[model samples]
Target chain A: MTKNILLSAKGLSKSFGGIKAVNNATIELKSGSITGLIGPNGAGKTTLFNLLANFYTPDRGEVIFASKPIHQLPTHKIARQGMVRTFQVARVLSRLSVLENMLLAPQKQTGENIIKVWLDRKTIKKEEKLNREKAMSILESVGLDSKAKDYAGALSGGQRKLLEIARTLMSDPKLILLDEPAAGVNPTLINQICDHIVNWNKAGISFLIIEHNMDVIMSLCDRIWVLAEGSNLADGTPEEIQNNPHVLEAYLGQ
Target chain B: MLNFIINLSNNSGYIVSLTILTSVFAIFALGLNLQWGFSGLINFGHIAFMTIGAYTTVMLSLSGVPLIVAVIIGAGLAALLGFFIGISTLRLREDYLAIVTIGVSELVRLVANNEEWLTRGVQGVRRYQIPFVDWEPGILGKVIAIALLTGIAIFAQWQLLRGIKNQFKEYRSVQNKSYQPTKPIVCIIWGAIATIVILFIYINGIISLYNYHYQAGLMVLALLILALVYSGLEILVRSPWGRVIKAIREDEEIARALGKNVFFYKLQAFMLGGAIAGVAGSFYAWQLNAVYPTSFEPLQTFNAWIIVVVGGAGNNPGTILGAIIFWTYDAVTRFLLPQLGIDNARLSALRIMVIGLILMILVMWRPQGILGKKEELTLGK
Candidate 1:
């Protein structure tokens, strides 16, 4: 059986000033698959994610998600279509409660409409209760339920990463693009995060992760794409990427 | 009790007008709080909305539109102005919005100054009708007013009770964390004292209804509107719609990633804030019985800013407290400075310097303002 493509970007290129930050990069994420993007610094891995999410309009390319062209859509509209991205640094709303950070994830909330907040009180209340419960359960799954009332800023670095991933769960996302999930995390927490990602993938959510940890990338990813100096260098399985001389030369500098 | 109220009200004109002015500015600052405080939109041209509101209402009333309808239309015009400005500038960086707003405010004031036919130029617009000017309420109307006042009093008491209960819950949560017992105890005492003061005011307001004067009636209406706007904002800031704007405030990118329409939410907040400021302008015109170009100066926008900052930007009740404190300072100094033998010109200048000093001290000592939470401070972000 052939798997369907969930997200596909074709010949995406972005230039800033005189530099080509992301030069003709293309990647495809199959439905319910875990894919890894690895690149040396300044390789434009994050910029490619921005292009895929439409946070930056690529100078030239088309992105199709869930069989619909999304390169022209606004970032929020693209997110609303069941695809969301996390930052290289966890960008949580520090002023709001952890629960509020989670509650903000679910798309199309009735209470989000100002008029309905007053006029549709019954429905809003019900929706809020349901969303709260869902948020709590997701938090509990990640062992963050106790901190629900605490400010998101109060969470530790690893916990904030966890919170960011858990927040995406509330949005019912079909595909999640994590910029870096284990950058500042400890070794133990990194393993835990990888376990959570595997569990979530098994639960039918697709992931496109940008990680530098070879262990994380090799163990969690079904396939890998490598970039160097803002261009795609190689694409292969974990063993193939490990053996690729071009990728080795790019990282090791001859 | 009636004799006491009569005596108090015999000399109440100054106090009544002062209270009305405070209420009007409180409403104005509340609008700014929703924009800058909660939504993090720096609306440096807030007074522009008030000017539009005042002028539109007065002009329409002069042309025979009903007073209430005129007020609504004025607010709508302010919101429309906000929409036009927002569409043009909200997509830019935050500082750009600030610059554009200040420029637009100046533009608005200049137009009011230049349009001789529409606004009578520097002569200003006057002779518009004030609401309840002929409120010689019959026995039935008087009774209804008393009942309404009593109902609001009861509602206020209930809110106070709820506040105490919430305080209790907070105390419980912090019980094991080396909490200071005196803090909540002092708060409870203050709440009790305030409840008593409100009861006294309710009775005084009822007695004054029997002696019905237009200025007093205006005071009552102004306070009523302020209360309604206050509670409405309280509800809004706690809603999910408010949550999205707040999220936008913290990081629009994060809100956008979470599927919130960041620009739309910003525009909504800006327009709604302008509408509220417009309502405040209508009240201001009614309070003064006239509208003048000088009254809508850029200084008024800064006055609202001071109120929001001193009261705690994100806190609604704090904004009202800031307005009351501000006006009290102004009123007290107006009388006190003359006794110190200062002439009028220097006295006015000295008054501003003192306010500046107080603000500087307050910000240095308690950067979050009186009611603002330390954790919620968005400054320096």
Candidate 2:
């Protein structure tokens, strides 16, 4: 069955000081699908993610999101177009409260403007109340509603990852590029994260995840793409990729 | 007691002058707080904004621009410079901003020092007209006016505490459930005590208002400007825009990832801070009745930084307290050193040594500052 592509990257390449971090990497995220990108260490999975999100400009090739070219847009602009990315280390603002971290996700807030922040107090307050409600509800869903007022830095490593995922939901993102959501997380929270991802996918959001936990990638991914040495190796159904000799060799070589 | 009152009143001019100077530095420190305290932008050359503000206001007004218009333009020009500087440097690492700002400040001072055609060079621009010059009330009238203004200020302080208490009512209730009285209760008590002290001073007639009305008027003007700028900043830092800046300060990369225009926000903060410094500069020029390139040394910028650090970075009230503490220490040291028979050069060195000692102690004992919250510091543990 064919699925509509929510995001696609073609011929993306990036280099740092004579080292090709990512070379001619091509991938796509289909709508309402949980796609997995797996690679050995230094296989350029994160570089690909950076290029797709416009965090780094590609030396070659282009990215299209929601049927528009996005290579020229800023990372935030790409995010505003319903594509959001999370860091592997869970980059929550450590000093901000959990709820504030959530509130920071929404785009185009009227209160973000200097003049409107002063003059449109009524509207800004109303919008803030609504955003707070939204953040709280999302936090409740993730079992973090009680810790909403706590500084994000105080959260356990697993909780910080959960908070990052929860924060992305605040933007009402159509596609989420999650970099290692399960890395360093305990087993129980990892299970919880997988369940949340599945539920979110069922509810119509697409995910492009870079993860090393084979169990997570195997169980959650509808399709899996493998990268080796800064280039695409193979992409297929989880079972097909599991049996593919080339994919096996890439892992063995690493 | 009467003799003491009479003696103090005889020196009212000196007291008022000291207060006016403190108020000016307080305004400068407040601007620094907005940038370094809230936004975590390291502006090492903040004095440049003050220099531009002072020079522009004086030059423009001298060339026949209206006083108010000139002041606004001066602030606007400072803000414009800040905007450009932020654009060129905000994207880089934090230390770059510090280096650039310090360099920029030196460059501005040098320009003012050499550009005789513009700034009048070493001689400085003196005898510039201050606002409300035509409305000078006589000595007795000025005294009464200052007393009234002090009363109003105390009342305003009380009201401000009450408003803060109301805003934190929920948190106080939560804290009460945990067996703590509301913190604002202490604040209210302090406000009450302050009001009573002012009343005591008025009833005792300890300080005569005679021959000091002009100074009193300047004091009132300084207070008014402080109230305006402080309130504006208070409102701003509490707004969503303020939150964004705080987030940027915490981590610009995360802020950008969350779709905030980090550059834009940083630039805005830089400019607003510069504009505030510019306002302080105008008041400073009024206090000195002159603008000289030498007056804007890097030491003045360090003084503002010390005020912010000692009062507590990120705490507005702390900034004011820091300014008062700083200027009082300065005045007291100057007076005491002379009385102690310290020669001029030695006296200056001793004064600096005392300030340095105080700063060292403060940094060691209360690095977060006198009023700063632990979590609010950029270097949170």
Candidate 3:
């Protein structure tokens, strides 16, 4: 079955003090598909994610999300536009409870408005009850329901990654940019995450993942994009990329 | 009742005045708590709002506006100042906000000092309208006012007793559930403190019935305002709006990634906190009986910080407790230090040194402040 493009970045470039971090890199994500971004250290893979999400502005580029140009928008605005990204180190509010971390992700919260917090308390309370129930169910799915009352800081490294991904689900995103979801995570947990991602993809959520685990990437990604030294080296099916000489050379070095 | 209060006031006027000062500073530090404790805005120039509120309210009252309306306007103007400062610095970084706020407060003080036509220069503004100053209550009015004061005193005592009872109940319940040999020392300490506080309030209430003057009335009003503000803030910090700000404080990037407008929320906390401090400034001006340029000093801002740090940054009750303890120290030292053979200048310096020592010890041992939770302490982290 054919799928339409969900996100497209054209001619993206960024430089810091005369060093081009991401040079003329272009990538696309199809709706209802899992895409992989793979590169060696300092190959500008993370920089590309930052640019696409508007964490860092590109000197020359236009990004279209769901058929709308979002490069000019703020990072929060882009996330509100149904695209969210996660950090490589799995950032969580250490002081907040695990349930609160999930509760913070929903957009257009009535209780977030200061005046409504006091004036329309009944509605806010109802909304809070609904959000809490939803958060609990999501936590239960990830087996984090038992630790909902615990601080996010107390979670294991792998659990923190899962929490971060689960938090994005609360925002109802169409596309999620996950930065190294499998990095530093134990092998058993990595497979568990891969399964969750495939299930989420089947439920119509698109993903762009960066991973050092080649087995996880090749098995999960429908298509792959390779970056080397701030430029795109190859883009193809996993089997094609595995056979491509340029992709092998970029990883092994000449 | 009036005669009884007047006689009692003859001996305890100093304590009554000190309580007024503590209450005003508590209100001031509460505003700082909302900004720094909960939102993590790093507002070092909190006194600027106080200065604006005092000057604006006094100037407006002198020009014939109603006292309450003048105070409201003062708070509004302070919030406006917050808006300007927040727009410029909130989008940048916390350290930048700190530098800008400190500089802006200094700028505000300088303007008050130089703008002779507006602020009357260093001489300061005097003889503004004091709230409830002109009322000459007859016999019936005095009886009603005394009765009201007595009723409030009784109510406060009842609450304290009930609180003590509840604490004991919970203590036993915890032991039953956990089966641990938990010590009762903390509970006993709390009960003793509550008893002392109850006795203090009763003494003040009895004295105020005789005094019945503007200053005594101001103390009651100030305490009432402090209670209201504290309760309001308590509710706010537990709300979803507060959750967003707490999130912003810990990691704004995560908040932004979750689609929250981080800059907007920071600006809101800044303006609201400034507005609260402005209200505190009005109470301060009333207590001082004059609004002076030197009154709003950089040192005054640090006084609020000391109260917040000593009490607990994120806890409202802790801020109030800090203010009470701090002012009690000031009052005690004022009389005692002079008797210790030290000159006025040295005595003042020594007082500050002692406070500094206490602060250092508290930082090392009880870094979360007296009332703060051990696990939730985020200082320096």
Candidate 4:
């Protein structure tokens, strides 16, 4: 609990019409820790993730990543600042090959520029070779190396989920906010995903994971934060959170 | 046999003209491919770019600017317009681009139609000097140019094949336990056939058969431009830049999440497509020997779209084939319908109807198009 803060959101709030989706929600992700965010459906967990990642601008909040104010930064700018997020439904480019999806995730690719792609052909090709090697190694780790040439649309739901996580490795981010990584995934893959998360955490990549599945949260999360009705309900270790009365009441009420 | 040969040679000028037209449209559709096919940017006003290109080139050249400078400026202007349009609309949903582009295109047409001082109004611009118009190439000169262009085309094809083989070598080897030389062999055979055809055509003095003295030079120019644009697009589409554009097309949010500036890539694609269209516009103006406000009508945009759709949205070879098919149908129907006693107005309508029917059938049975890969289409369904 005494770890250095990697990312933190303060006094974040957003509203749609008359409804306050996320109100005064504050959260912190410690460096090299696997944090879990849990709530019932429509508890504004995703909304909070959006705010933290700058996908949605908060009405009144400040996000600091690596001690730099990032609330004003765009989503891509925030990502470049060493924090990235994945969707609840894995948003892979289905038309592209699995390897293409991986290759697209890296930042600052020289070939990303139209002029550079033509003018800097040698540099681009060299960089691409290096990127492909990195992507293949990452795909190997996720057991998707064989499907590198396959269209991503051909992937199963679990494999797409695995690919989503694998893609984040290409960016070499300090923190990754995963939105419902275990949702709709098969049990075996769920275990595998948790194992990968643990391994990634051990390798110095911090994670803030949102999961409806309590088993994944209990096993993988170092500490858990519970949201109820767009506000913080409880925060503690998995054991303490399980016994928290308000957390139990909120889930029961839902 | 002698009469038949004479007749074929007599109509060869018309054939060359038709070929030039088809190649110009192929270039147009290639631009569309970069925008809609690869980047998923909807540009219903693509004709606007073509208009900007053609008019700018003609206007500049007529005002005493060098032909090459005029063409470069024309393309640059079109690209600048594309950049502005992209900045204004790319941040919104995809349909906004379609709407804005169509409106802008119509606005450009109207401006060209009414502006007498700049564009000469409805009278249109005519007889601007095309590149190499003064230099009447002899048979030997023509053959040399043809050979040089063909050599570039073949080298481009070989490089493409080698790149594909290198990129997918591991996957292919893994999929098929034995490595087959099928792809390279096929490519080499095709290259050889192309070389023989070029040599045969040039050696037999077929190039002299065109009635118009400028026809050979213009055709060669068009072919050279087409080859350069096609190869350029092929390289870009296979590069890392292309992957990012495809990713943006698939899901802008995901691309942004991965730290890519989605707007930036979209703008780049739009501008590049516009620049290519501008180049096509210059060729088009030369083909007709005129630049009319009516020529850049909305129908022109639809023609390019139809070509792209029929050929294979993302497939460049399919686009070229689609252009050839479309123009051949148009030419054949024009002659046949008149011979069958149809008036000009009715024949035109009927021609459109036939195209519509063909498109309908294609959509129903093969929406991915003649050469399009099914997996590449990002259809919602």
Q: Which stretches of candidate 2 lie over 4 Å from their true place?
A: A1-3, B1-8, B138-156, B159-212, B377-381
Candidate 3 versus the native: TM-score? 0.92
DockQ of every candidate? 0.60, 0.46, 0.44, 0.54
Q: Comparing to the true complex, what docking class would candidate 1 get? A: medium
lDDT for each residue of candidate 1 in B1-381, tens digit (9 for 90 to 100): 778767867756666678789989999999999999999999999999999999999999999999999999999999999999999999999899999999999999999999988888898887779988877888898787777777777876787677667767776674543222226886688677758656755666765677777776777888788888988888888889989989999999999988999999999999999999999999999988867789999999999999999989898978987887888898899888899999999999999999999999999897888767766764222
Tell me each candidate's TM-score: 0.96, 0.92, 0.92, 0.92
Highest DockQ scorer: 1
Residue pairs whose backbone atoms clash in candidate 1: none
Clashes in candidate 3: how many? 2
As a TM-score, model 1 comes out at 0.96
Residue by residue across B1-381, what tens digits does model 2's lDDT show? 788667767676677778779889999999999999999999999999999999999999998999899999999999998998899999999899999999999999999999899999999998777875566566576666667666656755665566556636745544522123337665567456545544543432224334535556667777778877887787788778988999998888777777888899999999999999998998899888777898999999999999999988887877987987898788788777899987999989988988899999988887888766555444242
Residue B248 CA error for candidate 1 (Å)? 0.7
